[model samples]
Target: MENPTFSIQDIPPTLLCYAVAELDFSTLSPNLTNSTLQSLKSCGANQLAGLLSSFTTITSETLVSLGSLAVGLSPSVLENINGSILKENLQSLSTINNWSATQASIIVSKCKVQSDKQINADTLKQLGSLVIGVQSAEIKTLKSDDILSLANNSILTGYMEKAPIVLKKQFVQGIIQATSKTKKTIFQVVPAELASEIPVSNLLDSNLNVSEINQMKWTSSQVLPITNQAQCKSYFTRVGQANIDLLPQGSPKRNTLLSNAKSCLNINSNIITKDNLVILGSLVCDLTDKEIISSDSYVLDALKICSSFTDSQKVAIVTKLKAQYGAPSKWTLSNMKQIGSLSSALDSEIMKTINKSVMIKFFPGLLSVLRVQHKTTFTSVITQLKNSSRIAARDSLTCEEKLTTDSITKQMDLIVARYSAAQLNICTSNETLLNNLNILGSLAFDDDQLKVFKGILDMRLPGGVPNEYLIQLGNIARVYSEKEIRSWNITSVDTLATLIQSASWQSNDSKINEMVYRYLQLNSPNATFDGTLLTVLAPYICSLNQTLIQNITSGALRNSSQSLEVSTCNQNIKNILFDKMKLGYSSVNSTSNAYFQIMSPVIGGARFSDLINFGKGFPEMDLSTFTTLNPNEVKTLSVENIKDLLGSNVLDINTISSSSVLQVWVASKTQMEVNSLGVNATAGIKSPVPNGVTSGVGVPHCTLYLLLVCIMASLLYMDNDFL
Candidate 1:
């Protein structure tokens, strides 16, 4: 039978099935011909099953070669196939439309085993029609994250559409259990199609915590199932304003919920107290205009609890306030503060009537909420008040007392500082007044304000923005566009360093890259960049292209004083930088703890062989660098090393478990070690640590260690003070 070279097509038709089954299937040179496979389909099931069992391993090619004869394979043979091989060929195997329930079940079991008992959306999608064969018990075992993935995936939803009701019920229940573990509610997790299948009793269950029901949209049809009026009122009331605000405005769902809650509370706007308004929350907008106007002014103030108010509500409140306060000219500062957001609805004439001091005090709050048209009028009114006030105060000065130049200058500085960014009349203000305006650094000027400020700065410093002015500008320096900053004459290293630090906070990547390029272009020599310059600009050095980065001299990197900030740099950039650092810092032994410590930031770029060479020094590497290592490389680390590396990150176990790639490395550990990693043991690992026993080591004591260190440091400081 060894090396049987005879073609199966040469076999007589009557003997073909017997010849195919009897042949040494493993020793057969080329695969069976398609005509041979077609003839084999007429063979008995036991004969075909025997032929399939001859191979030590089943591959996708073997299955494809079998064609329709694959259906004749015994369940036991399919069950024994390697899960990894099965997962690899699931799409091709799934193309077989006539699989029996038993065959499909075996495939699903193998798939689950391959995925470590957690099937994600892609696997579910590949299963396709075969998903119907999944058992309710198996569906219940799916991870919450996996369930959430399936719920979010539209492709999986199509698969679930044809699945059995029992499986769907189990899937929905899994969603409920999953959502309970996190801040998300059932409404947030379940899709529209599956939502209708959720039982009414489940919706009423108190396990769905009220506080967790913060934000999610629900259609009227979806919510209409919960017909318990009393329960709805209590749940909605406790859920607070956050949930109500998230509801789609003007949707039937919002209208239905409002109508139902209003009826249940027996809300009467005419007799409504401030307490009623507080309890009603966002439902206050549902009240009629006449009802709002009829409500007491004190009761109306409770509307502030709601973040947004309807236009009709604002109008009604304004009318009521005007009636209570009489004329706008007679309205006091107390009246304005009492109205709160109602001031946004006030006319320009009404704003002009307010005292200058009162107006300035109210402008900050009003500025944020004002309509576009009202902002212009308010800005104009404030400007006029500022000019008239300065004139009135100067004119009132006694004739005998002459104003000094210093006094006049000081007076102007005081007046400019008193106004807000919106009220600042930059066009009329002199250079001295603009320089004295220290208030510009504190306020976040809008695009228009920044444009005006830039114009003023340009006129004052016509040569270009100097380093001193950049320091003076503080956060406002960020307002300069990337184009303008790139065009600057930057020569000083200190200015470049300061600009890099400032740009890191608010500037986008493109802008930071431009700033670094501009500074380098101006300062660095045409032939060779300085080592000290590289060290100062280390954070942004990675922004350069690969060729440019490779061109940097090894001597420059070796002589650099500070560590390169590679956290924001991609793997390619880190690889180039790490290579340069390796060559330049040749004096440092690669296997020493010093090497790992110094190279920890860019160690992720190191090759697997290089990491293995680090040996004991590997433990000293940063945890973030460890997370990026290949799973196989991670597997080579000792259990004690893993415990040491992950001990401090026990709190991040959930985040780690969320990633399939990280989970593979985590699953490589012993059950006891995984439990010690501080997550639920039943999910994949072993028995949990006893309540009194600390899980892993480091993380729990990190704070106390810091505290002890601080105390010792303090004692050392005290001894030095005595010396």
Candidate 2:
């Protein structure tokens, strides 16, 4: 009666999704509720309602509880599956996920017998009994005989339709026999329906020791906006009109102070257009939200810019962006997304030649390009950029390729060189003078980047609670604290960490992020630094490979939290962790587990990995790599459903040995090299004899462990802080 192959074609995907959703209900209630049964009864007892009523065995409430085996679940989605006979039919599907030959045969035999019998009262009662027996057996169904052991536990309980029951010897013994592991009886078996509801999330914020409501309580009228949790997504947006400032009327000095404040805040002139909206953005300080009736795009962008800002400087740029780009949504994808395609989404609109330090800090990349390319002249590869507006005036040549046009480089004649930024009459609000600075300082930075950065730190943050006491945090920054950033290469690991941690955007809590970002920024390869710095940074380069050093540390640490944060804070970190771990990591047992646990409620990500791949390194988590999904696939796979599947797989992957017989497909990514053997290299010995086992168990091999320490030392030669 058993079939070798099985398909879930017995039910429609929609119906299946609905069944799972319904079982995942608010409470357990077997009795048919009037809300649904009424609709079915309207169709009469012997009709669709009658047939559906018979399916009471598989209510959505029951099925969604076995969440993993099924997909998405909704309330009342299983009105038809509330009956005893139907519930068994639903449980049978779990066989597909956890299928084995014997279980499959048992299922097939049951189905075959049911099909051969008549569909009357006696048959229905028999089927109900069988379904109850299946529930009792489910307790012992998991691998490692763990479920078997759980089933045998006195604490275990089961159900027959609406009633709960204890397992009998017949079903309990059969499951124990089928289970494979003796000592490995792992997790107690959760009935299939219960697993569906506790969908694990990939991104977890372990930092929060409490709930959101409790966290938000601190940000009330009593606390400063800095202490208040700023919405990380749109901290700069002026939610309503009051948050935005119009010109304040006062005496000349009052006007001057307000003007200076506006300039600092980046408030632009009041030019309310039909399409564009000019508002302040990127400040971490709080603002009250008011209604904006505009349905246009530019205004929305201005709103976004204002909202995106948190720092005082960001407020100024937001003012300028609104003054300049608040025209209309001439292009699609919104101004923010469009501009992001070219530069970062946050463009403070404030520029500074007078403040070269700020310019370099703000636009390091553009500064880097300018440093190498400025006086050195590059011809316009795409000669039309200078005449872009003219050509656009004639005809807007908006194409995918045109939109993505990169910086046009080519040979050019002697260009007028000046460190002064372009005076782009941007976001000045009723000011006495012109603010003429934009990115020119970044160009001149190669000559004075670090000096300017150091000056800025000395000015803004000042010697304080953390950094002033360098021995504590300065130590964290140097050495192989996390990834590739070694000790010698860094000038001030504490300074860098302080910068990122102290970022206004992360004003809601104690600053750990400030430390993270500063480390990454200075670590940029383009910026020239003393050779000793690199020697210290990639210390493994001296003799031991960096990857090997990381490997030794990770193995000793075991996928601990220390390995997690440093492993992902920078691309360099990922490179080292992945490479060292990948050297010979059995595909079946590979783990992407690790994270840096910070001690704050608010933390801006210095490492790129935190946001996109938050909980991935926390044990067993695998994320969706789908660039796009077709409508058909989307229909079958809702976000909730996909999330469920992903959550289960992520948690389970760790348990499943990475060294499985099956081939794993870890993405090909950059990694630090561990050991390289050239084809031409000679092996000193022709053959080496292997000892069958450790000749002596208790014997201490000081030499072997010493070699391991040596290897680790070689890899982290620059790990002064770690040492």
Q: Which stretches of candidate 1 lie over 4 Å from their true place?
A: 1-201, 204-224, 243-253, 267-275, 285-288, 296-299, 365-438, 441-452, 471-484, 489-723
Kindly report which residue pairs in candidate 1 clash with one another. none
Number of clashes recorded per candidate? 0, 82
Write model 2 residue lDDT over 1-723, tens digit each, in one string. 024353223434445432321221223244432233332223322122112212324545433333333222111122123344333554445322322222222332345444544333233233332333233334344343443444443323222212222223333334434432443221223222122121122012112222222222121121222222333112212222233323222324223433433443344544334322333332211221211222233443444423222244344444444555553223223443444312222322222111322222323333234334432211121121223322332322332111001111111110011110111112111111101111111122222322333233234435422334232222122212233222222335334423233222212211232233344456554322222122222212222233333424322222111112231133344345444433323221122221212111111212223222433322212322221112222233322333332443533322222321111111111111100111122222233323332323333233563677646655665565567
lDDT value for model 2: 0.28
Stretches off by above 4 angstroms in model 2 are 1-447, 451-551, 554-560, 563-620, 624-723
Looking at candidate 2, what is the lDDT of residue 499?
Answer: 28
Model 1, TM vs. native:
0.37
Q: Highest lDDT: which candidate?
A: 1
Give lDDT per model, in order. 0.58, 0.28
